[model samples]
Target chain A: MATGDIPQGGDTIAVIGGGLIGTSWSALFMAHGYDVVLQEPAKAAWPAVPERIATALRQIAELAPDLPAAGQLRLTTSLEDAVEKAVWVQENAPENVPLKRAIYAAVEAAAPAGAMIASSTSSLVWSELSAAMGDPARLITAHPFNPPHLMPLVELFGPDPDRLETAAAFYRGLGRTPVFLQREAVGHIANRLSSALWREAVSMVAEGIASVENIDAALVHGPGLRWSVVGAHMAYHLGGGSGGIGHYLSHLGPSQERRWQDLGNPALDRATQDKLISGVGAEARGRGIDELEAARDRALIAAQLALSGQRP
Target chain B: MATGDIPQGGDTIAVIGGGLIGTSWSALFMAHGYDVVLQEPAKAAWPAVPERIATALRQIAELAPDLPAAGQLRLTTSLEDAVEKAVWVQENAPENVPLKRAIYAAVEAAAPAGAMIASSTSSLVWSELSAAMGDPARLITAHPFNPPHLMPLVELFGPDPDRLETAAAFYRGLGRTPVFLQREAVGHIANRLSSALWREAVSMVAEGIASVENIDAALVHGPGLRWSVVGAHMAYHLGGGSGGIGHYLSHLGPSQERRWQDLGNPALDRATQDKLISGVGAEARGRGIDELEAARDRALIAAQLALSGQRP
Candidate 1:
């Protein structure tokens, strides 16, 4: 359970399922100097995983250029071979329950008992995923936000506290921000909060209150920028002036509650869905997915560096 | 009614209040090269307004360095004298209804007939504030997020379409992002969406689901970063792959609805308030309010530059 006991640069780690998430995780592990063994069941994906990993590593280099050289990348088609000698196993299979269960079973059976097992699943609860495993205590949920190599969040939750602590230490050593959940939840922490905000955002558009471009602009220029530095609670605490959250709650909490009650809950019916698609298309303004994604990644890097007090 | 007809730089603007918001507005107007006449009823704030405006102008200079030379800052105690011959007036008085009504009434009597009057009110709707005004057509609500000099959002709504258009043009001329609301709502667009997200964030903490530091980290590292680049609607559109938002709604909308139902609605009772204060204190980690505010401003400046394609 000690931080130093976890795998380091010289150690080997297994990355099961070499899709976007898996490849990004591979890049991160390799960048941290851990030899990565990548396994992908999809035959077509085998041809592109290396290129994706390379792109991810380039992004990592831009974000943190001082890291040690990346370790070797070992590609394998067999899960057992990938996990056999790895000190840590990171499963990034599709979100299908049965597929994840089978993968976990294979990993538990093939990998060493002391090998730390983690999942990149965003939606499923750990208890459900571990139902079929014999030693589920070793398995933990280490859900990273999309583009795992860049985003610092890695939400860790598990049945055993010791394993969770071990997983936390491992992620921390890799220079990632790992948050531990007290219990299992549907979307964990970040996605759940995202869903809450998105629900209201979509409702505003569906109700014809504002256009898609305006809503997005409001966020990027308004609360979204603040949220990047402080959480909602802390923002309110600061808004309370010298008294902090206590004064804010006493004076402004009622208004917040009133606003919450008045919040929209528009259903995503066919008409609403059409409006959203068209609105987003207008906002896209001829920018393709690749261009938008690149812009997002660049902005994220700049914001991250700025948050850490580094001049971008 | 046309954008060209609206006042531009070098035009005189009357700022009716000299608090935090009013000072920020004055800084922005001055930075944009508009002569600003600041009127503060509280004599105690008159001496500090100049210092606050200086700080805000410095921050604005960091965000936008190519602006014209700042206009003259005229200090006065009489609202009538401030608005007598000004082409535009920005009211940032307290949130009380009657005080705003009286201020508007006085502004209408003293200001020129064509002067565009705007309120920096965060909560009250325009119709309520203009109920007693003889010329409500010229009065509008132009709500800005905190630190108006740095944040680029300005929510504009009014009874007159032409007036709203004029206000939009004016804010755009000042290099600010202006969102027009189709109708009035409590907390406007940004605050409402912020409250929705904060409700779930507070619920998670009050329910013992996660700690304050962990929740804030999850947001700053996860969705908050994405939000600075794209709004929720566009993010979901991109998340849907090639088919866009329609596909995402049909496939994942149900799960979003489920999450919305599961979202919490926690009250700010005494115990909850205390927990929030303690949590924020721990997160602050001995950093005072001034330090946190400075950090937030720095991150915001970096984010704004990155979003605009400038290398910070």
Candidate 2:
């Protein structure tokens, strides 16, 4: 892919896999003036992908009124066509290792030697997946939070140093901040933290410590907002000095340690599992999956725009 | 002391700790039509407290546009006078158990016999602190989040169940949702989850897994927003049919155990502690203790009001 294949002043990206993440990648790439070519499995996913991308763009427009004219985005059905001569190929496919291995092999075979093949896989080990490719060094995980168009984070990881750097630069080009999981860890960063919290929440509910609504209320009404901005470390950092986290830990650390020890490791017992399923199913009562997912996409776009200081 | 002396439809609250929480409690009581007499030992804490309280009240007013009236909040120097004749004593004293024990004993002796003495201690066991009061049962931990006026969560716990219920009702009357923490725990619901995440973030930073800004960005841009609405459990619940805690655990539980084992358990070593302190201090460089606290209080008030549908 030559610099000319890229838009005159802006970059061009080819997002392979026009599913949920693929659509988001397209919108984000296009929003930044990247001519995007999204490859889907068949004609079946074509219409839905555009609709999803369009809805997100509309939201991006709403959240950021000053956003630049979005780049041109098109959909395709051929992987070879999408990757041929493309500056960047962001593969958003099934997270299965075997499947990723296959797709990456093809991506490596079809794309120009210089084109970066970025995987949007949230959990697969980068080295293992990329090793199957001819130039394993070219593949890097540019894992965006769900609804890539909105969320500002992109967890980048790969065994190869140059590949990781290129992937990071590409994401930055799209106004997305790429966070390197310097080491490949399961669930990467955010999901791992979330999984821990969710485990505790489920245990609390299963143990009858508090109702589901009460727990949700506790968070949304408490640190959720603060965490949204400064995060736990920074929040605690501020919380410690001036008597922030440090003050808290010193005064309350021992107590926290004691509690930590007592927090009975509530494994997923059959009863607890039932409690969680029932509890969550009840919570999701009326919302349609498609609608909820669309809403998530919009929220993500708004969040991304907010972080980037761009028009959503 | 009869319920009549408790003041029908009205009462005064002596807030004996004029820190961030004390001021917020003052605003909350004042907003609900109760006169508040806030007492802080540090005379230096005087000027800033009132200014912060005023700012918080303005935000409270904006959120709860129909808030009763303004003149309900007052500051005082006499701790004895603050508690005298008051129906409720909200002790925002430091987290030190001995200090709280001493304050509780004094406040318990000072306030009307029927009055409730509530501690805002986040981690201290209630039974230990309550043991010091004249009517130990009257004491309870009404742990409010930072900027209590804004955040509506109050983790209520006590040695006595009846008293716990009464305290819960009292907080509910003040427009705060009190979740009964089954027993004393570190960080309570929200903070515990926060601590776990912060610990992970620290480990990640220590390991160079990601940058400070990128981790924070991931949260605010992703789960943070979702958490602000439905929170962790509900989020995983909607992750898929086989999602939520049960499915997550069954599918990824071993992985969680693996990750937990892989997680760095760095002690609060002197160097690391200082690193945290300096890092956070750098982030909060320009904002003084008072200013940052006030800003936090105001934002909390707005958020709390928004959660409770009281925000204008």
Interface RMSD of each: 2.6, 4.7
Task: Write candidate 1's Cα lDDT for A107-225 as tens digits.
Answer: 88888778878999998989999999898787899999987898888999997876777788899888798998888788999998999998888888888888888888888878887
Can you give the lDDT of residue A65 in candidate 1? 96
For B1-312, candidate 2 gives per-residue lDDT tens digits of 442233323578889888878887887787777888888888888988877778777777876788676646667787778889688888888878898888777776677778888888876767778776667778877889865876777887777777777777778777777877766655567776676666666666666676665566666656775565556766665465334446665776666556555655555656666665565555565677667655554544443333343210
| B1-312 per-residue lDDT for model 1 (tens digits) | 222268878989999999989999999999999999999988988999999999999999998899999999989999999999788999999999999999989998888888889999999998899999997777889999998888889998887887788889889888788998888877888998899899989888888888888898898878887777677877887777666777788888898888888888888777777778888888888987777887777777877776675211
The best candidate by DockQ is 1
Q: How far off is residue B160 in model 2, in Å?
A: 6.9
Highest lDDT scorer: 1
Mark the regions of model 2 whose C-alpha exceeds 4 Å error after superposition. Answer: A1-12, A31-35, A42-47, A66-77, A158-175, A241-264, A282-312, B1-10, B41-48, B72-80, B105-110, B132-137, B158-175, B241-257, B274-312
**Candidate 1 docking classification:** medium
Q: Give the per-residue lDDT digits (tens) of candidate 2, residues A1-312.
A: 542132332556778787778887788777766778888877877878877888778766765566678877777787888878578878888778887788777777887777777788876777778766776767777778765766667887877776666666666665666776768876778887776666567667877776666676677667675665456766665565477766866765665455555443466667777776676556556665555555554443433333333211
Q: Provide the overall lDDT of each model, using Cα atoms, as 2-decimal numbers.
A: 0.85, 0.68
* After superposition, candidate 1 runs with Cα above 4 Å error: A1-4, A310-312, B1-4, B310-312
True-contact fraction in model 2 equals 0.41
Indicate the residue-level lDDT of B293 in model 1.
80
Q: How many backbone clashes does candidate 1 have?
A: 0
